[model samples]
Target: MTTEQLTIFAILAITLGLFVWGRWRYDIVALLSLLAVGLFGLIPPQEMFAGLGHPAVITVAAVLVVSRGLLNAGLVDTLARHLTRVGEQPWIQVATLTSIVALSSGFINNVGALALFMPVAIWMSRKGGSSPSLLLMPLAFGSLLGGMLTMIGTPPNIIIATYRQESGGTPFGMFDFLPVGAAVTLAGLLFLSLIGWRLTPKRKEEQDTSKDLFEISAYLTELRVPKECKFAGRTLHDLMAAVKDDADMSVVGLVRSGKRKALPSIFEVLQEEDILLVESDSDSLKTLLDVTSLVLAAGEDQDQDQDEEKKKKKAGEWNLTEAIITHKSILVGKTTSALSVRERYGLNVLAVARQGHRLRERLGKLRLEAGDVLLVQGQEESLQSTLNELGCLPLASRGLRIGKPHKVLLSGGIFTVALALIALELLSATTALVGAALAMVMTGLVAKDEVYDSVDMPVIILLAAMLPVGQALETTGASDLIAQALLEIARSASPAIVLALLMTAVMLLSNLINNAAAAVIAAPIAIKMAQGMEASADPFLMTVAIGASCAFLTPIGHQSNALVMVPGGYRFGDYWRLGLPLSVLVLVVGVPMILWFWPL
Candidate 1:
């Protein structure tokens, strides 16, 4: 290898090591690698930041914003509501849920699609008396499968399209991916719904039932002391003494006149009308209320009064929702008390769950972390803004809102028009998606401020940063060298065998790194391999697209997989049990489908 190739390969080796080690965040690792290549003179300084402005990057960002718009408009929720009525059989429920997730993913961000359906899956699992593990993994896997169905479905497809464009060919059109993608998605869905779900380990009994999976009712509830309460003037310690031994409750905080005193002193005296945030179970809550004669602050009468007050003020329209913290979230490492969650944003943190465990720390004292699911109650408009500002993804609620049909139709119409524009070659994919996203904002389907928040920064950064690194591999002839090695291995084998091996290699790489990065690196090699074999580049390129989306066997492989791990109560090893078979099925089915659609 030449010196430049050696340098590129070494940088990639360390970068991949850090990614697999996972000690540092992926975006940070990617950015550092990008800078390293620039420092080594592999990538010209003028073109170092070009990836950030690439059409592929723009399309990914616009697609994410549009996905959020679809979510905010309740288009997916309306569909899920109907699916809930598709009978209670485990197989039927899994089939319906996975199918919807897969279909939605094709049009929007796959992770967002999975997030929208996760709560629905959990609710169905509870109703059907089955472990969420069975439904969640399939839902996640379906999201991955669905992304292959459209040009804008996943980042890898966009990356491949952009690569094709750079090679002096027209980028893949809107429906170019449909045939192979649809066939694979259909085959994968059939396996998951019928036999694959059964292969998932049953861990319902192993999960902690004390806390609900959704953390809806087990949240920290605020109770107000009524005038008729018997412990009106008693100190915090004295009141606790009354029910300390009888209930599993703790005084999390004391909120008086809208101000909070977290972890208040034991000698603090409680007055009538003081709202105490208590952490306890249902039975313990009832016992505490009976012992202290306290009433829930959110009781029916109070809620009605609050509603009336909201109408008068026109500012207190609050909603209860759950959000997961992303790696880029500013809230990480800061305690709720420090951030003044309630005081600053007019929001209340009801509960926080991390890695399937309900944190017992005082709500205010608990420091937020990436992947922590927070149950927050806040004003509807402000809540969405706050979660976005804090870098959190709001999980869709199980309850459907009124008038969803109108918003759903409006959002669907806008997205469909954009797709048509792309299909007709009237606009590029990026331009079309940007117009659609702006239309969603203008129609009030997605809030103006939320447009930027809808784009996942980590994903965008990962893709942009890795683009030049991929260029380095190509320019240094490293990609050509690797393709030749593969050609040698498959020299005697049939073209079909060569195609399967190439797909498997890309799939394995995708499971280790970001799928977008895998695609950027593997796409060039695929084209080179096709050239060496004197075959059309279409089949090899299609193989790269299919393999890049097949990120199964590890939670870290894809965001959708990671999103399901905590909620599903899945251990690291659990994914391989079902993912391995699904992957094999993809290779078994995908090769034939690709050759059929775009023959080599």
Candidate 2:
């Protein structure tokens, strides 16, 4: 290998290793790799931040904002509520949910689209008297299927379109991916709803016992203080023994004189009518109330009226919620208390949940980390805004609101016009997308703030950093070298075998590295392979797109998989059971779909 190739490989390997280990954030890893390339003199210092201005990066960010706007407008939720009425049958429910998700993902951000419908699917499973595990895998897969349809539905599609523009000076139109993507999506959804969901292991069935997996059940209940209660004068620690003795109850906070206390210490003196935030089941709670000299309140409401009143006076009321921080987040290290989150951003750190283990005391003192779930309560508007600003993802489903569902036709019309304009080669894909985004803003379908709010900064940063790296790889003949090796290995194989092998290779690479990175490296190789075979490039390119996206075999392969891991209570080994077959199914169906549509 050449020195440049060796350097590029080393950087890519280190980046991928760090990403898989998940010790450092992904955007940080990408940025560090960019710096490494610069230090190695592979890329000029002047071009270090050029990826930020790349069309792919710009398009991805714009799409995120647009998707967020649509979500905020409630377009998906309106559709989701109706979609859940498909049927009582498990396969039918799964099929309907999957089909809806796939279709929705075609027009908006697939992740956002999935987020909108996940709650609906969860509710549907409950109503149908089944486990959420039966439906979530299909939901995620459906989102992936839908993302392949439109240009802005997924990052890979955006990257491929930009790559096309960079290479050929004319980008693929908005609907260019639909012919192949639609075919693959339909077949895959059919397989998942019918056969793929059945392959899931029985252990996944057991995990559905705890609907809210953050263990909130252990942190809510009734508490009392009697007239002769000596514990009234004692500190919070004096009551610690009583809490331990009561297995079902935990002390969340104190409510005194119809007022909420903020982060009370162990030595804080308790008074009469000071309610302790205890968590326990009905029996344990009754047992504790009987033993203690205190009488339980008639209503088991945790928050006092005065606390509610105070919250009402504020811009928005403070409410508790559980959320997980993403791997690419910026607010992973600092604690909410340390950051003065409440003071600065009007958010209070109520509790922190790390890997299913709940930390009761010193909740704010605990440092935050990626995958750490937090139970936070604060002013509604500020807290939601802060969560977005802090990069924390709410575990629960949020109701999406578009400005007006009444404007659905107008919103749809504007985007349709943009697509048509692009289809007719009247405007570049990037320009057309930007124009659609502008129309959405102008029509008030999305607000000004909504435009920037949807974009994930970390994802944008990662894309920007990796673009130059991809360019360097292609410029160094490394992508060519990798492609040549694959061709040589498949020299004796038939075209069908070669296509399958290429798909498998790309699929494996996506599992091992970033999917976008895999596509960048493999896309050119596919074009070269088609040239060598004296065939059309469209089939090969489409094959790479399909293969690069079907990374379900491992949790680390796709962010969607990582997202469902703890939420679904799945073990590391559980994914391969369903994922492997799904990947195989995609390969089986995708090959014929590509050949038939692109016609090599």
Candidate 3:
């Protein structure tokens, strides 16, 4: 190998290692690897940040902004609320939920689509008397399928189209992905609804409180403070000390002489026969009872005022909701006490769950992370606005608000016109989407101030920084070197065998790195592979595009997978169970479809 190729390979190896290690953010690791390229004088200094202005980058950013506009206008929310009525059977609910999410993913960013529909899936699981695991994984996989339908649905498709253009071919049009994409999506959807869901682990049994969004029966319990209890005279805050120091729980309510306090003060003093409505998140329930001398008791009805007028005045007095923290959540990386949730918003952080288990740390000191589901207690009046500002997605099905008719019309209208222009070849994808995004701001469909916030900066940076790195691989002939070595192993085989091999390799790599990165690095090698076979590059290019999107094996593969992990209660090993079969099915179903459509 040449010196430049060696340097590129070294950078690639280290970059891949850091990605798998996950010690730093993907954006940060990508930025550093990009600088390493510059320090080695690999590329011209002028081209180092050229990726930032690439059409693919611009299109990605524009799509994200457009997604936010749709969300702000409540288009997806309205559709999802109506879509959940597709019968209550597990197979029907799974089929309906995944189908709706896939269709939505075709129009919007996959993460945004999954975010809006995931709550619906959770609600369906609760309503259908099944564990959420069955629906959540299918929903995540369905978003991946939907992304294949349109070029604008995923970053890999856009990047692959750009590569096609640079290779002297007509760039793929907006609907070019639809023929093979739709076929693959349909087959995958059928498999998931009928057979794939059975592979998903049923992580938890349905709780008795069927209406609750998340299963937390083990996290919640009732205890009675007796006269013989040594801590009777002590404050509730003091009683909290008797519980594990690190574990998190809350006294959500209390009963004193048949009068219940919805939110008992932490400073409230414990008394004889006081029924403490406690929530313990740890496995220390038995230990807590033994240490505090508290006895288990049945909870009583907390029906408040009988006065109709008084009830009307306090219509939203107390309510409980489950909220999942988004990547954009302002609450990320901070403690609830640090934000003073109670003091600032009249909300209580009753409990928090991470990675399919309730956290055992003290809630006050437990720092927040993206994907942590929190059971929040607050007044129903201001709950929606508070969660919005905090960037939390409430799991309640009714959290979505249908916008004014005009706003919805304008939001959907702007996007549809943009797509029409792209399909008609009147405008490039970048130009059309950027125009639509700006129009959203002008039309009041999206607030101008929040436009930048709506864009996913980390993904943007990762894509932009890695673009030049991918270019460097092709320029240095590193991708060709790698592709040729594989070809030598399959020199006597048919092009179809090579195609399947190439897709499988990229699919595995994507499970380790970001899908867009996988696409960027693999695009050139695919062209080389097609050239070796003396066949059309379109088939190979499509293989890489679809392969990159098949990040179903690992939680870190795609944001959609990671987003559903905790909510679905899936462990790291759980993914391959469902993902393995779906991937094999995609290969079996996609190769024939690609060759038929693109003519290898």
Candidate 4:
């Protein structure tokens, strides 16, 4: 091999190794690789930073920010609140939740859609007395399947379309992927709801009543009413309703004059210095206190009007409940001190989920990752909003979103305009998307600070770094070598077999590597293979796009899988049982669909 080839191979190997190893962060790895390539003169100095400004990379980031706006605007929340129900049968709940997530994903980020419904799914499972494991995996897979339907649904489709542009072809239109994406998503959803969910391990129902199925700890807490509290003069019933409607808190009982009252009457007048035994978590309670100016009475204070009046302005009395950080969050690499999560989003991390794993140091300094459930305490609204912003799926059985419900049309309209422009080819996809993101910001649908907060910087860097490497491969004729090898192996096989083989291979690689990386590496080889076989390139490319999206076997394969890893309380092995079969089902259904739609 030439020195350039050998050097390139070594760099590629290290990049793959580190990404799979999950020790160093991906963005760091990408940045280092970009630097190495530049130092070696593999790419021009002027073009070294070009990947950072690449249209594809920018579009991905903009889309995420826009999706965040849609989320904040209460688009998904309004729908989810209506669709998610209590006391339904497992199948009924699963069907509703899965269908909603899939349909929602076609427009917004699939992971975001899943995150919206995760807490609701937990509520359904607990109410129905079924295993959440059975339900959540299906919900996640449904989101993944649904995202395949549109250009904006998943990053893989966008990446492939961008690749097509670079290779001198028009990118796939918004609905071009729908014929195959819809077929697989519909069929996969059917099998998953019918058979796939049934195969999940029955851990939720089998767990002891003492332990939460998600393994999160619940706490009892007291809220002290300051003189300024909206509830100070209101009766217990009115206070309870107000709390539920605005503050995300519930009234467990009332405490008056140093005595705890069990189930106080709704008409009981809440007064200053009265202690309320609220059942909500620290985060929710904090938000309630912040909004209503309530305090957590730490001491046995029978202190009446004077002390309560003096303390009314102090905002620090909000109760602190603990939450465990799951291993699956974007917060894995950050710390409370470093990330300034409390100041930035107004949530405090009270503890970490070692999960029987040893902690080397203080919890405050430890960086979090997927499966590390957090024990946190904060204001209810801020905490819930923070959870949504961080892309951390909550383990609690409650729903939360951050927009006025009546503004749904505005949010949907903004998103629709952006999508329509891109879909109809009136503007570049990147321009239309960026325009939408700005609109979301300008309209106050999403906060200015949240624009950057919603995006995964690591993903951006990975895509940027890998783009150059992919270009290098294409430029160096290495893709041709790999494609020739694939063609030689598949020469004796029927075209259908070749399509299946390519799809299966892409699927397995996606399970191992990042989905975008898998696509970046595989798309060119697919094109080359199709060229050599004298076959329609569209089918082969579509096969990779579809297969690369079928990251059903592992959490690492898809962002959506990792999003639910801890909230669902899943083990690494837990995914395979449902995902493996679902992947097989997709291949079986998808191959034929591809053959029928964009025949090889």
CA RMSD per model (angstroms) = 6.0, 5.8, 5.3, 9.1
Task: Please give the CA lDDT of all the candidate structures.
Answer: 0.83, 0.71, 0.84, 0.73
Show pairs that collide, candidate 3.
247-360
Candidate 4: tens digits of C-alpha lDDT, residues 1-600 = 577767766787887788788777667777777777777767778887778888778888988998888888788888777754434677777788898899999888887888778767766675666666768889999998998898778888888888777656788887889999998999988888778878776764435312343232243456788876777788875665555444434454466765555445556888998887655556667767766677877654524422452243143333233233444355767875677664466564544554323243444457776566665555544555567566555665222232346568998999888878877899988899999999989999888878787787778888888778776666667778888887788889888888889999999988878888888888888888878988778888888899988888888887778766655557789899898888888888888888898876
Per-candidate TM-score against the hidden true structure: 0.84, 0.80, 0.85, 0.78
Question: For residues 401-497, could you state the per-residue lDDT of candidate 1 as single tens digits?
Answer: 3224448889989999999999999998999999999999999988887888788888899989999989988898998999999999999999889
lDDT per residue for candidate 3 within 277-331, as digits (tens), equals 6667556677788778888774343223223213432555666778889877888
On TM-score, the leading prediction is 3
Model 4 stretches astray by more than 4 angstroms: 209-370, 386-393, 397-404
> Model 1, residue 285: what's the lDDT?
88
Q: Which ranking of candidates, highest TM-score first?
A: 3, 1, 2, 4
TM-score of 4: 0.78
lDDT score of residue 182 within candidate 1 = 96
Error of 3 at 375 (Å): 0.4
Q: Give the distance in Å from residue 282's predicted Cα in candidate 1 to where it truly belongs.
A: 13
- Report the poorest 10 consecutive residues by lDDT, candidate 4: 208-217
Q: Which regions of candidate 1 are displaced past 4 Å?
A: 208-323, 375-405
